[model samples]
Target: MIPLDEARARILAGLAPTGPETVPLAAGWNRVLARPIAARLTQPPADVSAMDGYALRAADAVEGATLRLAGASPAGKPYAGTLGAGEAVRIFTGGFVPAGADSILLQEDATAAEGHVRVNETVMLGRHIRRRGLDFAEGAELLGAGRRLTARDIGLAAAGNHPWLTVHRRPRIGILATGDEIALPGEKLPEGGIVSSNAHALAALVASCGGEASILPIAPDDPAEIAALASSGGFDLLVTTGGASVGEHDLVQKALGRDGFVLDFWQIAMRPGKPLIWGKLGAVPVLGLPGNPVSALVCAVVFLLPALAKLQGLADTATPTLRALAGVDLPANDKRADHLRATLTPGEGGVWIATPAARQDSSMLAVLAGADALVLRAPFAPKLAKGEPVEVIALAALGV
Candidate 1:
């Protein structure tokens, strides 16, 4: 069996980002940018007031000084006339500062009566004014390519006069669950048959990682059925759960091989998901995961998440992990790398304490669901006592 890192590298190397598509600015949030968003126009296009105040010449805004009220300048409405000596213009936030005005006297600092205003505080030059292009200049790069746009980025893009944005098309994934013993939820079950959960669970994982998922019909154990269903193309990547092992019933590799599927690798040195499959069926890639519910989801977190990120043109595809203290003593690991499902709790000094569940059966979905993180134990790792440091992958942080 190949090491997990090599397996992951091979899977990512076989994929390329989806092509770019133009989308409305409102729909750009959470989508990876295909092209950099350059400012179409400067922000605060001209000198504007940053606060509600009176725009006037600094030389005439001294304490106890009275100046004639010139005109009013509200947001989106600028005073046409310039301020003269001993003159002030009533200006509100976002209002353009008229020519010949170099300072702002806050309204609270000045009292206006009839046609004259008295300054209670001395005004400083260039104070409380948002200068032209203060936020961003025309032609400046506001958002870079490969970035996942956020709400703040949308606002900035709007302020930069962008009505549309170019982003990568969401990756399309086809999920296939194979087995005769498993049936869809709520379907009539044969004796000893179980409800299928891997397809929908993996579909949710794909969606959380920004990929579009399509659940294909369940393929029975027959090689012909698996081959026929897998050959019905129109997907960027195909994910199959179950039927990956060497058991007589596990026929994913055998079935796909009939359709000229080139095998990259099939096994990895990892617990609960050793019978993993990664290969190419003609132009489409296929990732066959283990049948066990826990193993399927864990493998998805390890392999599928990065594949989705790469397909979306994201700059970083590495799975993010956090450091936590072991809440219980851990046993030494063997050759296979282990992902121990554990619960996390806040500890002293902002540290997290992770305690592995007593039973970690790969088929038990309840224990996996109650887990907050997966404590990573490298192959041949030595035993550790409580309070020792450990690296953990936070599940909720990944939106799984």
Candidate 2:
């Protein structure tokens, strides 16, 4: 058993970044950029009007000056006439500022009669003009590599004149389960059978972490059948939740070894999840999690999430750590670090008060649903007093 930090570092170090592929801009959202995207054209490209008014030479707008009205210039259409002293062009918002025009006096600010207009207020040069390339210069870097594309990123890409982009391809995960004790959900359970919820939960977990997940049929704890199924290829990662412990029917470890696979870490110093296994089968990374539903999910959040991020060249994910005051006094364990399920409620002083659920058992689903965070209690921690501060991991961060 090792410290949790040491275990995380080891797992991260063994992973590699994913490769890049070109994808249509529409489908690129939530994907990481493979390279910098530079602007292909200048925004606005030319001086344009910022409002519907008259475009005139600012110097000609002397206190009592009146200007002859030129042709109208609406958006997407520009007047051929140029502004001169005592002359103004009728311009609408987004219309090109006619050549020689310096500013615009809104119609509300001037009096119009016949073919001329009167300047009712003083105007400044360069007012109401959107200069060429003011928003973004041509060839400017608009998006950088490793940046996650959001809807906003797509809009930025379109603004940068990019119709498509290169991004990291999502990893494909294969999920398998080994245990005759489990049966598929929605089917009648046999005398000693239980519903197989872990595989579906794992599949959902993989997708939330940005990977494509496929749940294969369960492999009963038969050594020959397990070895054959586990050795089959076609996935970047393999995940199995059962038969990972030291029990006699725990064939996952032996099945991988029988096919010449190298094991990494088999167990860690964590409660309800000490018998986790990780290794490589051929070129695929394999994670054998414990059968306990909550335990499997916790391990997935702790390990699999980081693996997917690593494969996509994403930065190390920061867990949502919150400071909370304990609402109850509790005894402490000395070896395995505990992740106690707790219900959080808003408290005074801008803090959250965490009340550990009464049923801390790993297999209790009803109590887990009511929990919004897992209060992390360190191994060997002394008995905690009520109102003491403790670090909590937000359940939402795990994509629960």
Candidate 3:
């Protein structure tokens, strides 16, 4: 067994980013940008009025000066007339500033009667005017590479005249479950048989991580069945739950190697999920998980999510970690790092506290139902008292 950090580093190093592809802007939300998006046009293409008011030469609009209204200028349509001394154009918001106009006096600040307008207050030059390129200039780098395309990013890209964007393709994951003791849900369970819940859960995890999950049907304990599936090489990553330990039914390691997988690490120094297998099948990465439901899920949170993020060229690919206060005292454990089940609640003063559930047995699925986070207790951790600070992994951050 190796340290958790060292195991994580090795796992991350083995994965490589899949190439990029062009996707329609509408469907590109949460996709990482593969190329820089440059602005096609300047914001406020021309000097325009910022409000409904009069556009005139500020020098001519002295205190108490009266000016004749040249014409009306609304948005989209420009008033094609020039403003002369003591003359103003009736301009609405977003209308083009008429030629020879250097200022805009707001309608509320001026009085209009007939075709003339009176200015009682002084107006400064260029006031209430949106100069060309005020927001962004043409050819400016609007978005950088590797930036996640969000709704606001999409809006900004559209404003920059980008109809489609180059983004990383979603990683494809192949899920395989191996064991004769496991059966799919809704099926009749024989004596001592359990449902194969890990594959479905892993598939959902892949989808939440912005990847496609291709779940192969349950592979029985037979080596031939497992080897055939591994040899197919139909996915970017292969995730197999069960058959990773050294028990009699464990065949994932041998079958994967028979089908051409180069092994990385077989186990990590972590509790409830010590029998993790990381390797590669053909060119695709493979992760062998424990048979227990909670153990598989915990491993997925620590390992699979980051693997997916890395495949998509994301920089911050690890699970979301936060500093949270411990609500109760915690005893230390030797040898293995523990991810204790906990519920995180927001308390007063904007702080989050984690309360570890008393029942932490890996087979207890009921405890995980109400869990919102996993309190990460490092290996050889000292006994902790209440109100002690600790690191926690949020469930939402794990894409659960």
User: How does each model score on lDDT?
Assistant: 0.95, 0.83, 0.88
Most TM-score-accurate candidate: 1
Residue clash pairs of candidate 3: none
Query: Model 1: per-residue lDDT, tens digit, 289-336?
Result: 999999999999999999999999999999999999999999999999
| lDDT per residue as tens, model 2, 1-400 | 7766667777777777778989998998888787889999998878888888989999987656898997788998888877777799988988999998989888778888999989898888888888988889899999988777889989989988999898888888888888988888997776798998899988987787678988887898887788788877787778888998899998898877888778988888987688888888878888888998878877776777877777777764545588999989978777888888898998997899999988888887667777898888888898999899988988876677
Poorest 10 consecutive residues by lDDT, candidate 1: 183-192
lDDT of 3 by residue, 115-192 (tens): 999998889988999999998999999999877778999999999999899988888898999888878899987579
Question: Lowest lDDT 10-mer window, candidate 3?
Answer: 229-238
> Which runs of model 3 end up more than 4 angstroms from their true locations?
60-63
TM-score-sorted candidate list, best first: 1, 3, 2
**TM-score for each candidate, following the candidate numbering:** 0.98, 0.90, 0.94
Candidate achieving the largest lDDT: 1
lDDT of 2: 0.83
lDDT of prediction 3? 0.88
